[model samples]
Target: MSMDELKRRLGQVSDLNAAAGLLSWDQETQMPPEGARVRGLQMATLEGLTHELFTAPRTAELLDAAGTPAGETDAAVVRVARRDFEKATRLPTEFVEEAARARNEAHHAWLDARERSHFATFAPHLGKMIDLARRRADLLGYEDHPYNALLDEYEPGMRSGQVRAVFADLRDRTLPLLRRVTAAGNAADYGVLTRPFSPEAQKAFAWRVAGEAFGLGPAFSRQDESAHPFQTNFSREDVRITTRVEAYWPACLFGTWHETGHAMYERGVAPRWERTPVSAGASLGVHESQSRLFENLLARSRPFWERYLPALAKVAPEVTAGLDADTIYRAVNRVQPSLIRVEADEVTYNFHVMLRFELELALLEGTLRVAELPEAWNAKMHDYLGLTPPDDARGVLQDIHWSAGLIGYFPTYTLGNLLSVQLLEAARRDPEIAAGIERAEYAPLLAWLAEQVHSHGRSLTPAELTERATGRALSADPYVAYLHAKYEDIYGLKAEG
Candidate 1:
């Protein structure tokens, strides 16, 4: 009876989260512009109520009654719920509501600011966001750095020191290979990707790949258009992915595949786990691994294009009139320094992530002022990618993370990149998965990941999941080795050092 009651209470929390998720989805997709004012209040009210109910003294009594669970699933439920309850109890209900309001207002302001290519319009909100982040960190308490508190929210048990060490090692090892790739003058004929295609045609081709090819069907999950591409779900059975359509086709095509990866992870979680603490991905980094694995490893591989290029031709044959598999593969894999993180090539992508990670650290540490963010951002772009943003849209305002109060989220993208390679190498070891990749049949591969990674949900930590899935601790060696091999094959330059 006690376990049953605990489950019932946890189910209520999930339902509330789903309610908030629906509000956020509508605000992003369908809500009118002026509705922002009321929407923020609605979000805050839900958030406050959610926090209060979860942290009530009654929950403590229930946990004491449940005691130590014996079974694996029951143990996980008690353990995670207890951890969350302790943390939520530390944060006041007013803080929760205020943070939600700040996030909502700032999100709308960010849309307008990015469109206008203005940072000043969003600076005050970012300041408030940073202040709230600091306040939350203080409320939560931290040992070494306040940033650790925020980062731990996304990557459990991870610290800024650990992230710094990992990124430093990655940058030291990969930058040389990146320079070699850059110095090689064999530029891909990337113009093929930027050619004009009608929006309707682009949508049809992209969703076909997402739905028919990638296994995200209309019944369980669907895709939509948003200013910035993202995937969110109220439940495993009701996943939604969104992307922006561009005149250039790669943005929509690759973006759809990227988000489909996230949707698949959410959809693949064991259905019996829904409305529970363990219903989501193990961690944001692990979640990112799925997205990156699908986006880069699978979608951009030679076999994938070989299989899907024909399908694409049937949908938008004008763009592929004279194109072949090798050309499309090379075009998609071209290594170049790009101003946008989303468009960055595989080799240079982490540099974009690293830049944001460092800037976020500085912001949280109070070493950098919010007003000086654009200048700091431009400097990092020049240092890391050898380019400078000409405007705020291309610079500090490019990402919605800060405006939406996602302070510690940027580092997970790089962690996701590293884990993506580690997980793929592990998955490919299975002969069925290996052959499935060779033949462009992803069912075996997807099934492998569903069994290995997605099915557990939050039952394990990122490290535990990485070791279980890959048979080793998370290391940059596989990722670096993968880069060296793939880029050397493409550019005819060995970056061995």
Candidate 2:
């Protein structure tokens, strides 16, 4: 088949995936409680169809027939399609459909289970998902570890052992920094965020800042609310993010900032690449870097609040009641060991991912059972962050990942945190981006990412993209140094040279 025919075929597969993606977007946003029953089958049908279309014998024939591509973009299309075909062909359509149905059913079960704080209701579903993941890993055939098979799905070319080493280094460095901050007590007045604020005002101000401050304008991108905060896109033209609003102000403010990072990156992908395999961000880790960068490196910084606080004050006067940028910055950056991963402070956040990664490995290995998850989870929480859960809602049932069959996805969160700082360091080296950031104009930074990371999409591997953008491979040093300097200043603690 010709290159055009290859792209046309890939585009058709992309369209099928897009249709399912729209259903997923609604599944999280607008679908009613009863809709989940049918939604599972609906999504499963789409999954199976896309799998069949992508993995057909003709795809491999086409991939081989395409001679050396003329450009990076075309080469990427052929290359990515081949990689996907290898994985897709490993599983039968029946397996794909079953996994999808299981994921959909488990997702709904998770929601209901979380609301009731009952793990028993969700345990059987989680077991089914875990069993499915094991079967998938077996089908995919990993050499070192079964988890690596699943991990590669989200972060291609990344291995579980590499993640383990990185996490160990990160945990060692973070613990000392967290200790100093904890020892110093609360440096920023926690009262600023802990106090009640209007949910409406919070949403409006956050949404405005997301569009204006971060450059994720609503022309092609939009924001809404969901049970959990996430960003999704059907194509570059239509990107969506959902953030939960609650009594705690940061959930709306930072959640919007985080998802805006994702939406902006999605919206920024090169238009010519649409409906191709390379259309989306490089990987979930790379995608998470954008969200982490926007959430912590940009919006969470003092420079951002310096300009936006008054705007927030305009909408919710309570936020700025005698508070200045520095005070608010310190408060939002406070080191608190929390039960919820999403609500975790920066210093302790990766520990949450580590806990989940370890738990996932165990669950996948049959060393841990779904029934024993809460106890194991509480123990890890105590071991890692010095906190215990009062209920399963804040414990095992807190995150929607496991129930949705996202077993190998947790480690990407930490990878993103590390890469976010790495990307920020690289961008700030550009005088234009640095100036834009200080002035609360994000276009330069966004444009820099568009040119360097976003535009390439999945054309480049995550490691290659990180190296090209940052001039170095992924490292925890930059992220660790970043947290130390920022927190030491906030808490008035001295750091070891």
What C-alpha lDDT do the candidate models reach, one value each?
0.89, 0.89
lDDT per residue for candidate 2 within 33-149, as digits (tens), equals 888889888999999989988998888878889966888788888888888888889999999999999898888888899999999999999999999999999999998799999
For model 1, residues 47-94, the per-residue Cα lDDT tens digits are 998888889888898888989889888888888889889889989999
Report model 2's TM-score to 2 decimal places. 0.98
Model 1 pairs in collision: none
State the weakest 10-residue window (summed lDDT) of model 2.
Answer: 310-319
Deviating ranges (above 4 Å) for candidate 2 = none
- Listed in order, each prediction's TM-score against the native is 0.98, 0.98
Which run of 10 residues does model 1 get worst, by summed lDDT? 185-194
